[model samples]
Target: MTLLLLLDDPAQPGVVELQSLTDDGLPEGSVSVAADDLASAVREREADRPRWVWDDTSRRYPPLLAAGVRVERCHDLRLCHAILRRSVYSQSSTLAGAPPGPWDGPREPPPVEGSLFDDVGPSVVADPLAELREQLAAVAGADEPGRLRLLLAAESTGALIAAEMQRDGMPWSVETHDALLVSLLGERPRSGRPPKLEALADEVRAALGQPSLNLDSQPDLLRGLRAAGCDVESTRTWEIKALEHPVRDPLLAYKKLSRLLSANGWAWMEAWVHDGRFRPDYVPGGVVTGRWATSGGGALQLPASIRAAVRADPGWKLVVADAAQLEPRVLAAMSGDTAMAAAGRKADLYQGVVDAGIVETRSEAKYAMLGAIYGATTGPSAVLMPRLTRAYPHAVALVEAGARAGERGDVVSTWLGRTSPRPDAAWQAEHAAASAEGAGADDVRAARRRGRDWGRFTRNFIVQGTAAEWALCWMASLRRRLLELDGRPHLVFFLHDEVMVHAPAEVADEVAVAMRSSAVEAGRLLFGATPVEFALNVAVVDSYDQAK
Candidate 1:
C-alpha cells in the first residue's frame, strides 16, 4: 500500500490532507483528518503496512512517535530525490534533468511540534504527488532499477531510525559523567582551567624552559619547542610523540585532557543531556559515501574515555554488537574472490590471511588488506601488497580498476549503484594543462600527483560505500527483528558498524541472536549465495564500556 501525506495547512490548523495511491501510483481516493485524529488515522492505516510517502521522514515521523504511533515503512521523498539527482544510474530520468528547486537543499533541521508546518519554504506547499511520481519514474527508468530502488529504500529506513533514536535518546548517567570528569581532570573551577590541566600546562612549560610560553598558541609553542632543540614541523600529537624531549609526555597529556574538557565536558552535558537521556541530532546520508554524520552533539565520535557514562536502566542490559572486519568482508563478498571469501569464513579474517601465507603476522595482514582497499603506496602496506595481490587477485583487481578509472577522471558506483562524485572543474583544468603540447615538467608532475590523490579516494570509495550499504541493510533487518521480541528492546546508539540495543536482561540474548542473524540476512540481500561471512562480536553488559 502507498499513501501520500501532505503537511497540514497552517490555515486549517489541525486538518491533515492525505491521498491513497495504488501500487502503480494512480490515486484511489483522498482523505482529511484533524490534528487530534491524525495519529488514529495513521495507526489504522498501519494495519495494512502502507509505505507512507512524505516530504521528509525526519520532519514527519517524530510527531507520530510522540503520539505513540509507529509505522512499518516509509519512502522519504527528499532523501530519495537527493540520491536520484546525482546517481549515475538515473542520469536519463526527468528528475535528473530538471532545474534545482526546493528539493535540492540540505534537510532543514527538524522543526518543533505544533509549528511543524511553519518556516517551511516552497517544498512544504509544492505538489508532493507530482514529486512522488517523478521520483518513482526516476528509479524505474534507471539502468539498474532494482539496485537504485533498494538503495532508496534502505536510505529512507535509515532516516526513520535516526529520528527514532534521537527521540528515544541514549541512556546517560550525568552523575557518572561528572565523576569521570573530576577523576581525570580535577574539580570544576569558577573560571580558569581545572587543577590537573593547569598542572600539566606548567609541567610542559617547565620542561621546554619557556615559562612564558602560551601553550594554546600553535606558533608560539612551535617556536618554544624549536628553541629548546626539538626540531618538529607541527604540533600534531604523532609528531610530538616521535620527538625525544621531556615536554612530550606532558604536552600529550595536556592535549588529551583539554579535548575531554572542551568536547565532552560539563558544558556539553548541560547542553545535550537532559532527564537521563543524551539525544544527538543525527544527519542521515550526510557523508558522500552514505555514512551518517551528527549535525550536533558529536555522536559519531563518542570518545572511549566517556563511554562509561552510558548505562542501562535498572532491569535492562545493553546488547552491543560490532561487525568484525566489515569492509574487508564486504570487499570479499562483492568481488566474489573465492580465496578472500574463504579467508573470512572464520571469526578472525586477518588471522585467516596469515594462515593462507599471505603475510607474516596479523598486523601485516591488516595493513595489506587496508592498503589494497585504500590505495596505500608506501611503508609496510606497500611492501606487503604483492603477496596479497598474488593470493587474492580478484579483490585486488576490483579496487585497482576503480583507482585507474578515477585517474582518468571517471566516476565509479558501489555494488548497489550509489555513484562516486566526479572530479570538479578545477581538477579537469589542471589535467588538461598538463596534457597540453608545451606543458612544463612541474605542471606534469603536479597533475600526476593530483591524479594519484584522487585515485586513492576512488580506490576506497567503492569498498567503503558498499560497506556502508551492507550496514544499512543489517540495521534495517535488526530493527524489524527487535520489534518482534517480547521485551521493549530499542536501539540506543549506533556507530559506523556497531549497534547498541537496550533490552531486558532476559531478552539481551535474543537481541544478540537478532544482531548475528541480521548480518547473515544483510549479506544475502547484498551478495546472494556468497560464501563470505559477516561476523560480529556481541556483548551484553550493564554499561557501554563493559561491552569491549
Candidate 2:
C-alpha cells in the first residue's frame, strides 16, 4: 500500500491532498482531508501500513514526526530523483530523456519549518503523479530495476532516518563538552581567547625566537619558523609534523588548541547542543560517493577528542557498531575472490592478509591493498603491490579496470547503480590540447597528471561507492529491526561506517544481535550468496567514547 501526502502549511491546517498510488504509479483515488485532520487521517490509514510517497522526506515527514506519527516505509522523491538522474541504469528511460528542465535541481527542503517555500503550486516541482510515472518508468526500464529499486529504497530510508534523527536529536552532554573544552583549552576567557591556547601561542613565539610574531597569520608564522632555522614550504599540519625544530611541539599544541576553539569550542556547544541534544542538519546522499554530509554543526567531522561528550540518557546505553574493514569486504564480494573473502573472515583485515602470507607485516598488507584500490603507483605501496596482486588477483584486477576506464574518460558505475560524474569540459579541452600537434612537454605532463589523478578517483569510486551502498542497506535493515524491538533502541548517530543506537540497558544484548544480523542482511541484499563477511565490532557502553 502507498500513500502520497502533499503538504500545505503547518500553522493553519494539516495536509491538503492525499492519494493512494498503485503499482503502476497511478493514484487509485484521492483522499480529502482538512488541514487540522491530517494526523487522524494518517492514523486511520496507519492500520493498512502503506508506504508513503512524498516530494521530499525531509520536508513532508517532519510535520508527521512532530505529530507523533511514524510511518513504516516511504519513497522520497528528492533523494530518488537525484539517484535516478545520475544512474546509468536509467539512461534510456523517459525521465532520463525528458527535457533538461526543473528536475535538474532538487526541490529544496525548508531549513526550518514554515519559513519559506510553503507555496504549493503546479510549478513548485514536477507534478507528483507525473513525476511518479516518470520515476516508475525509469525504474521499469532500467538495466537491473531490482538493484536500482533496492538502491532507491535504501536511499529513501536514509533520508527518513536523517530527518528523524535530527528531530529526535542525538543525546549530547553540553556540560561534559564544556568541561572537556575547559580541560584542554582552559576556561572561556573574558577576552574570548582560550587561555591554554594563548599559553601555547606564547610558547611557540619564544621557541621560534620571534617575540612579536603573529602566529595567527600563516605567512608571518611561516617566516618566523624559517627565521628559527626550520626550512619548510608551508605551515600545513602534515608538513609541520615532518620538520624537527625547537618550536615543533609547541606549534603542534597551538594548532590542536586552535582547531578545537575554532571548530568545536564553547560557541559551538551553546549554538548546536540544546536540552542535552546535538541536532545537526544532515544531508543524505550529500557526497559524490553517496556518503551523508552534515549541512551545519560539523556532525560528520565530530572530533574524537570530544567523544566523551556524546553520552546516553541516564538509564540508556549507546550501542556503537562499526563495520570492520567495510571497503575490503565489499571488494572481496564484488570481485568474487574467495581468498580475499577468507581473509576478510578474520577480525583485522590487514592481519588476515598477513596470515594468508601475502605481506611481510600488517602494515605492508594495509598499504598495498589501499594502494591497489586508490591507484597509489609509487612509494612503498608500489613496492609491495606485486605480492598483493599475486595473492588476490581478482580484487587487484577489478580496480585496475576501473582506473583504465577513468584514464580513457569513461564513467564508472557502482555495485548498485550510482554512476560516476563525467569529467568537465575543461578537462577534455586540456587533454585535447596536449594531444594536438607539436604539444609542449609541460602540456603533455600536465595532461598525464590530470588523467592519472582522475584514474585514482575512479579507482576509489567503485570501492567507496559500493561500500556506501552496503552501509545504506545496513542502516535501512537495522532501522527496521530496531523498530521491531519495542522502539526502545533508536538509531541516533551515524558516521560513514559506524552507527550509534541509544537503547535501554536491558535491551543492549538484543540490540547487539540486531546489529550483527543487519550486517549479514545488508550483504545478502547487495551481493547475494557471496563469500565475503562484513563484520562489525559492537559495543554497548554508557558513553559513545567507550565503544572504540
Give the Cα lDDT of each candidate.
Answer: 0.89, 0.85
Error of 1 at 97 (Å): 2.1
Tens-digit per-residue lDDT, 472-541, candidate 2:
9999999999987864689888999999999988888899999999999999999999988899999999
The model with the greatest lDDT is 1
lDDT of 2 at 318: 92
| Candidate 1, 362-405: lDDT as tens digits | 99999999999999999999999999999999999999999999
Candidate 1, overall lDDT? Answer: 0.89
lDDT of 2: 0.85
* Collision pairs in model 1: 14-35
List runs of model 2 lying over 4 Å from the truth.
3-15, 106-123
lDDT of 1 at 179: 97
Candidate 2's displacement at residue 536, Å, is 0.7
